[model samples]
Target chain A: MIHFDQVSKRYQSGHEALRNVSFRLAAGEMAFLTGHSGAGKTTLLRLVALVERASRGQVLIGGQNLNRLAHRKIPYFRRNIGLVFQDHRLLPERTVFDNVALPLVIAGARHQEIARRVRAALDKVGLLGKERLHPLTLSGGEQQRVGIARAVVNKPPILLADEPTGNLDPELSREIMGLFGSFSNFGVTVLIATHDIELIQRMNTRTLVLSKGCLVDD
Target chain B: MRAKATTPHFERGPRFQLRAWLLRHLQTLFSALGELTRSPLGTAMTAGVIGIALALPAGLYVFLDNVQAVGQNWDGKVEISLFLKDQIDDEAASRFALSLHKRSELRHVQLITRAEALEEYRQLSGFAEALNAFEQENPLPALVLVEPTLRYAQPEAIKGLVAELGRLPAVELAQFDLEWLQRLHAIIHTLKRGVVVLAALLALGVLLIVGNTIRLGIENRRAEIEIIQLVGATDAFIRRPFLYTGFCFGLLGALMAWLLVEGGLWLVRGPLAELASLYQANFLLASLGLRASLVLCLMGALLGLAGSWLAVRRHLRGIEVG
Candidate 1:
């Protein structure tokens, strides 16, 4: 579950990334965030990830107010939320398995547990056979799958993606969107930030549109 | 295929937590080692630089240790030379030397008759031709050399003994160069202090060297660090590998320092032994023994850890998932 209480983020350079934006998503709900390039979608995801704090209002996840979270507690808080990027953000030098196992490793999971979970996650992404292969060797769509596998490796309750299908072809984008749909179906709250209106229409999910740092439509 | 993907959470006991913590550290340790091995030349160069820095101080310490050992052995060199009165004949002086030898404070006493004294001066002073001009009547006084026992070998004790001997019958002057002995000790003390200062400076240098290397490593892995941070890796987890890298650098550097010092001492030992033999001293060069090498290695490892910690603290703050 994610909730924003009229959050506003004003950068030091006088740029407002988000302005008085408020939204709430129940557990297991999936939603798409649509906005122009400079709109506040990425900033919204960042606030959820606690990469940046809201300047004016409270951002809550699972009823926990993130604005009050201590600096040292941020890592533990983030463990419950998975984030995916457009570029995959996989360590190019590492194997697909290693890339996926990172989150579990960060969680201090046992070796056996990590191996099992990582394999399961990889299997879900159809990357079971490419575990030993490095991310760079994989195709663009496959690389994005590796990133998705990494995001859900720990079975985080909430998954956030920022333009995850940006670099993929239309078919691959559809496939990636389907992967997100499956995660949501399994009770993982998903918020995908993208400007791909056609893909949003095709996915037929709840959409929140932003323009000039304000929620224009939802 | 709808898989039941509900998250399962379990509470672990402290023992399990500790084991998992240790396992993670072990993984990071080996991974850090592998990273160093990946760039063998660069690692070697960095480690070599640290080795040279550490060796300067380590070598000086071993050198000081040997010098102190030589100083201890030469406690007998603090001898008191007693010159007999001109009226005292050779037999009486020899008898006096024999009597002096009975004292517990004296280790040895040898009588140098006037003729023997003249002959020693003629051979050593380069005044053999000048000494022949006074061949009929030798001008040198009969002498007695008295070496104090080890327990009474301190400058103060020797000075006390010299004063006591000065008052003895048939002794014109109890001559001992106490100033020279004191000067030797002063020189050794100053050199020891100098070595300590140099060691401190070089230790600081080692810290900086390791710190800078770790900083560069963090910079190069900036992207990976950001990714890990975004994925909820704690500062401690991200820092573990870099700390290990520094530790390996320090440990390897210490090994290299030991080799450099031992190899240097080995090469000079032969010449040093020859020199000692020429001086009639049974002295051998002392190498950096096992205990000292172990300490050197420990210091290197600690410095590496500290340097990497400092670098990580400073730079990790700047790389906040940007």
Candidate 2:
């Protein structure tokens, strides 16, 4: 579960990225956030992931206020959430399986468990056969799929995607959305931030729209 | 029920967690080694610099040790001459010399009767034939040549021993080559201090070299580090591989330095022995003792670890999730 109770964020350069944004998504609920290029969609997701702290108010996940989390606990707290980026952010030096296994490795998983979980996550992303291949050798869509596999590999309760399909074709984007839908059905609280209105309509799920630095519609 | 049971979050037994922790450390350590292998030339260059830095001080120290050994050898030969009292006869002087040999401090005592003293003086002095003018009176007094044991031959110890011998009733006066011994001890002391100072400076150099290399390593892996941190890896977890990298660098550098020093000693051993033989002295080049070599290696590794720790602690703080 994720909640933003009147949260706001401002950069060091006096740029207001978010202003009094408020929203909540219950456990197992899937939603989309739509906004223009500089409308703070990324900033809002960053707050949920605790990658950026709110300048004001609280951002809570599963009832734990992230603002109160100590710096030392930040990494461990991140174990409970998953994030996927538009550029895939997969390590090109490692194999697809290793990229997915990063989270489990960070969690200190046993070798057998890491292998099993990585294979299972790769299967979920329809990348089970490409586990041994390098990310650079894979197509952009496959690379993005590997990133998704990695995000969910730790079995995080919540998953956040930031323009995950930005570089993909329409077909690939739909497929990636379908993968997110499947994850939502499996009880993961999925939230995707993208301004692709047509894709959001095709998603046909609950959508929140942002304008400038405020949540205009939800 | 099946989904809950099959979730990746299986029950973590205490033993299982312990094993995971061990596995993680080993993996990181080995991965650091693998990373070195990935860029062999770079690693070698960094380690080579550390090796040269380490070897310089170590070589100088070994040289100083050998020089000190030579000084000690020369010190052992220093003689304290006890000119017997005029009333003392050759028999009395011989008795005193024999008694002096019984003391633990004196290694050797040679009694030179008044006749032998005159003969030795005649053999050395250019006015040898003129030395016999005292044949009737034999003005050269009966003498005892004293050689102290190696330990007592040191400048401070020899001073006390000479003073004690000088106070003997049968002895007229004790004469020791004090000025030369004093100067040798002073030079040895200065050389020892110089070795220590040089070692410390070179150690600091090693630290700087290791730190700069580790900084470069961190910079190269900056992207990966950010990603790892974002994916829930703790600072310590992120630092483990780098620490191991530093450790490996230090260990390798120390090994290189050790080899360099030993090889240098080996190459110079024959020539040094030959020079000693030219002086009719049995001297050999002193390689570092086993303990000293081990300490040097350990020091190298520790410096490497310290340098990397400094580099990582400073730079990791500069990196934030935002």
Candidate 3:
């Protein structure tokens, strides 16, 4: 579950990213956050990632207040949250398997467990046969799938994807959205931040829309 | 497919946790080693700097050790020379010389009365006819020649002996040195201090060299590091490989320095031996013993580890998950 209570974020340059935004998602629920380019969706997600602190907030994930988390605890707190970037930030030099297994390696997983989890993740993304290939050799959709596999490799309880389908074709975007649907089916809460209203309409899921530093509709 | 249906919660026992801990460290250690081997030239250059820095001090210490050893073996340079007062008669000086023969330090004590002293002085001064003019009274004092055993002939020990003899009622002045021995000791002391200072400065230089290298390495890997930090890698996890790289550099540098110092001493030993032979000495060059080489290697590795630690502590904060 994620909760943002009266959260506001203002950059040091006097630009307000978010203003008094409050939201709550029940445990095991999935939803989409829709907003314009500068509507502060990324800032909200960044607050969840603990990458940036809110100017005034009580952002809570699983009932733990992230605003009160120490800097030293940030990494461990991230262990439970899976993040997928818009550009598929997989290390280009690494093989698909290494890219996926990175989180487990950081967690000091046993080699056998790492192999099993990584293979399972690759299989889920339908890239099991391309584990040895580098990320650059893959198509954009495939590269993003690799990124998804990496995000889910650790089986993090919460998944946050920022514009997961931004660079894909319509069919590929549908496929990627379908991947989120699959995870949501089993009670893994997923929050996808995107502005594509058609995709949101096609998925028929809960949507929270932001406009001009405020939540305009839900 | 339901995600939790196919995936049971991944949990581990304590034993598995321990094994994971061990394997992770081994992987990082080998990975760091691989990074260095990927660029042989760069690693060699860094290690070479450390090697030269370490060798300067180690070689100086080895050289100084040999100098003192050789100096210790020079026994025949000088011995105790006791000058009796002019008031002492020939019989009294002879009695004192006989008493000196009872001491273990004095190997041979020769007594020369005033008559014998004047006669030797007449020959050496080339005043035989002028000496005949001093028939009224011989102005030369009685002399005692005391040859000390080799064991007690060290400058410090001889000085102690000279002090003891000067307190004698009949002795006027005590001579225990070749005069050059005191000056030689002062020079050796000064050189020892110089070597210590040089070693300290070189050690500091080694730290800076290693620390700078690690800092550059951190900068070069900035992107990878940010990615690592993003994916829940702790700072310690990210720093592990760099620390190992520094340690490897230090270790290899120490080995190279040992080879350099030993080879250098080997080259000089031939010439040094001949020179010592010319002086009728049985001196051979000294090399770093196994214990000393082990110490050098340990010190090199520690310096490397310390340098990397310092660099990481200072720069890791600047590289937050930006």
State which candidate, 1 or 3, has the greater lDDT: 1
Order of candidate numbers by TM-score, starting with the best? 1, 2, 3
Error of 3 at A111 (Å): 0.9
Rate residue B220 of model 1 by lDDT. 95
For B1-322, candidate 2 gives per-residue lDDT tens digits of 0112122353388888787778878888899899999899988888888888899888988887888787777665888999899998877777888889889998889898988888877866667778657657787889888899889887789899999999989999999988875687788789888878988898888878888888888898888888888888889998888889998899889988999999999999999889877766888777899998999889999999998998889888888765
- Best of the candidates, DockQ: 2
Query: Could you report the DockQ of all the candidates, in the order they appear?
Result: 0.40, 0.42, 0.31
Clashing pairs in 2: none
TM for candidate 1 is 0.90
lDDT for model 1, on a 0 to 1 scale?
0.89
| Cα lDDT of model 3 by residue, B1-322, tens digit | 2333211234478787787678878898899899999999999999999999999989988988887766655445455668999789989999999999999987888998999989898876778889899899997889898877777677667778889988999999987654665566677789899988997898788888889999999999888888878778887898899899888888988998998899999999999889987766778898999998999999999898888888888888799765
Residue B85 of model 3: what lDDT? 91
Return the TM-score for chain B, candidate 1: 0.82
Relative to the true interface, what fraction of contacts does candidate 3 keep? 0.37
Top candidate when judged by lDDT against the true structure: 1
Candidate 1 Cα outliers beyond 4 Å, as residue runs: B1-11, B83-91, B101-145, B149-152
